[model samples]
Target: MAKYNDKELAETSKFLSFVLRHKPEAIGIVLDREGWADIDKLILCAQKAGKRLTRALLDIVVATSDKKRFSYSSDGTCIRAVQGHLTSQVAIGFIEKTPPQFLYHGTASRFLDEIKNKG
Candidate 1:
């Protein structure tokens, strides 16, 4: 595996988040309704846009992200953000289910009073 430094990894992670979650059109690529993008097409488009990208770097980002923000297809040919999409085009398939007895939600400290009063 090719080694990547922190700067390379951070930059690539930001790039992936932008293209996969927000504006894929910025690179002239389209994500599927499920937000998956063809890895090869993404690489080409990003290169054309003056960004360096590769499968190895993508693998590193997906594997090392603390948030686990991206995932690969079953056959490893496609990739997508796990969540946090700002675009309305993606219809992420989420299953609705009854909440567990104990569920945790993370929020900023400023929201604590509002949550306590409203929740």
Candidate 2:
């Protein structure tokens, strides 16, 4: 059976965190105002940046991340980190959100379809 181990999963998580949050430029991608980036574009950029990334792998990374950091757009075409994008050009919006360590913070309800809020 083919499956990703902890090291691979953690590595991918870090990579995703970097691209989805602080430096989309690392892979030559752009994030929207809400810190969401196109999943397809993210894959392509990661490839360009010398990372062997794929949609499947990305899904696994997002799923297995302990912090529940990343989320997919409603259409599943885009993704973003829950927080820690402070150094990013696009600041994630989190208005009228559930307080107390909003792990899924900035995920606007309107975009909930696009950017899901995972607990």
Q: Give the top-scoring candidate (TM-score).
A: 1
For model 1 the local lDDT of residue 93 reads 90
Candidate 2 per-residue C-alpha lDDT over 5-106 given as tens digits, one digit per residue, 9 for 90 to 100: 888888999888877777788778888889888888888878888888888888888877788999998999899898888554786667785657644457
Q: Please, what is the TM-score per model? A: 0.89, 0.75
Model 2 ranges off by over 4 Å? 97-119
- Backbone clash total for model 1 is 0
lDDT of 2 at 109: 72
Worst 10 residues of 2 by lDDT: 97-106
lDDT of 1 by residue, 1-119 (tens): 78899999999999999999999999998888899999999999999999989888998999999999999999998999999999887999999999999999999999999999998
Clashes of each: 0, 3
**Candidate 1: regions farther than 4 A off:** 106-111
